[model samples]
Target: MGRTVVVLGGGISGLAASYHLCRAPCPPKVVLVEGSERLGGWIRSVRGPDGAIFELGPRGIRPAGALGARTLLMGGDRSQTQHSFARPEPSAGASGHSVEDWRGCPRPLIPT
Candidate 1:
C-alpha cells in the first residue's frame, strides 16, 4: 500500500509529469493513464495514403521550449529534430521531422 499519482492523458505535459514523478527521490507509483493505444497523443506521426509520414502538431519535439526539452530529454528523433529545435516552425521544415528519411537513414524506436 503505497502512494500513487495517476496522470491523465498521454500528451507531452502528462508524459513529463509522469516521468518526473517516477524519477523523484522516493518516487510514487506513477500510473500514466492514456486513452489511446499509444502514449504520445498530440505528438504523433501518421502515414499518408501515399505512404508519407506526416507529423501533426510538432510542439513536443521542438527543443526550444521547456516541456519539449523535457520530453526530448526522454529522447525523440533528435537527428531530425535537433537542427530544427532552435529554428521556427512552418518555415520549410517539411522533411525536418520525417522518421524514415532522417538524415537519409532509418529512425530508431528505442532512444539511445
Candidate 2:
C-alpha cells in the first residue's frame, strides 16, 4: 500500500495542504484530522437573527503571491464554498496575517 500523509488539522492550512497534496502528480493518501467538529479552526463567522454577519477569528485570505493565489483560485468545487478560498471574511482588510506569520506558526500536530 502507498504511504498516507496524515494532516492533523482541518483548518485552512491543513485543507490547503491536503488540496496541494491531492493535486500532486503522484498524490498519496491524505487523512485530515481536526479536533473540533468544524474544519476552519478559529476562523469562524456567525450570522445574527437580524441579518448581520460577524467574524470571530482570523478573517482573511493572504495568498503567498500571485501564482499561489492563482493556483488556489484556479480549480475547485466553487459551488460548495462559494469561492471561499479567495474571499476574505468581513472586515478582513483591517486585520490579517502575513506569509511569515504562517511560516513561523508551530505545527501542533506533528510529533517531535
Candidate 3:
C-alpha cells in the first residue's frame, strides 16, 4: 500500500505542498482537507470592465527556496489594470541614471 499524505488547509502553501508531494518519485495518496468549501483561499480573480482578469493577494515573492510564480507584476502604466495604487517605474534612459552611478546621497548628506 502507498503512503497516504494528509494536507491541512487549501491555502497557497498547502496546495503547493500537496502538488510537490504528489509529483515525487514515489507518489503518495494525498488527502487535502480544506475547511472552506472552495480551494485557493486567497487566490481569487476579478474580471475588469474590459474583460481583463486580475488576481489579488501577496505583492512580492523571492524564489530563494522555490520557483515563485506568484504576484502579477505589471510594469509601465497601471491604469490598464485599474490598479491606480501602483506607481509606474522611471522610464528607461529618461533620468540618465544607472545603479552603478551613485549620484551621492540625498540633499542633507551632500556637500554644497
Candidate 4:
C-alpha cells in the first residue's frame, strides 16, 4: 500500500499540490479535504437568468502555468463565458472601495 497525504483545502493551491504529489514517480494516496461542500474555494461561477455566466468569486485562470492552462482547457464553455461580461462587478464598483469590492477587478491583480 502507498503512503497517504491528506490535503487540507480544495483551493487551487491545495489541489495543485495534491495533483503534483499524485503525479510523482512514486504516487501516494492523496485525499483532498474541503471544509465547504463545494470545491474551488473563493472561485465560483453562477449562471445568470439571461443564460449568461457570472462569477460569484474568482473567475478564470491565465493560461501561463501548466495547471492553469489545463484548467482553462477543461473549463471549456465556462471559461468562454468569463470573457462574455463587458465589465465585472468588482471592477465597476466606485473607486477606492473596500477590499471586498476589489475582488473581481477587470484583470485580477494577481496572475493566478
Best by TM-score: 2
User: Model 2, 1-112: lDDT tens per residue?
Assistant: 9979999999878887898899889999999999988987777866666644556787454558886676557444444333222242333344654422334433223111
* lDDT by residue for model 4 (6-29), tens: 999998778777877877899889
Q: Per-residue error at 86 for model 1, in Å?
A: 7.2
In each prediction, how many residue pairs overlap at the backbone (N, C-alpha, C within less than 3 A)?
0, 0, 0, 0
Candidate 2 error regions (>4 Å): 47-54, 71-77, 80-112
TM values, all candidates: 0.51, 0.54, 0.53, 0.51
**Which of 3 and 4 is the better model by TM-score?**
3
Model 3 TM-score, all chains together: 0.53
TM-score, candidate 4, is 0.51
Each model's lDDT = 0.64, 0.64, 0.58, 0.64
TM-score of 1: 0.51
Report how far off residue 33 is in candidate 3 (Å).
Answer: 0.8
Report the error of model 1 at residue 31, Å. Answer: 1.0
lDDT of candidate 3 over 1-112, digit per residue (tens): 7799999999877887887788789999999999998787788755666665555654333444324332233222234433323223452335665422324522212111
Worst 10 residues of 4 by lDDT: 77-86
**In model 1, which runs have C-alpha deviations exceeding 4 angstroms?**
46-54, 59-72, 76-112
Q: Candidate 4: which stretches are off by over 4 Å? A: 49-51, 59-112
Where is the poorest 10-residue window by lDDT in model 3?
103-112
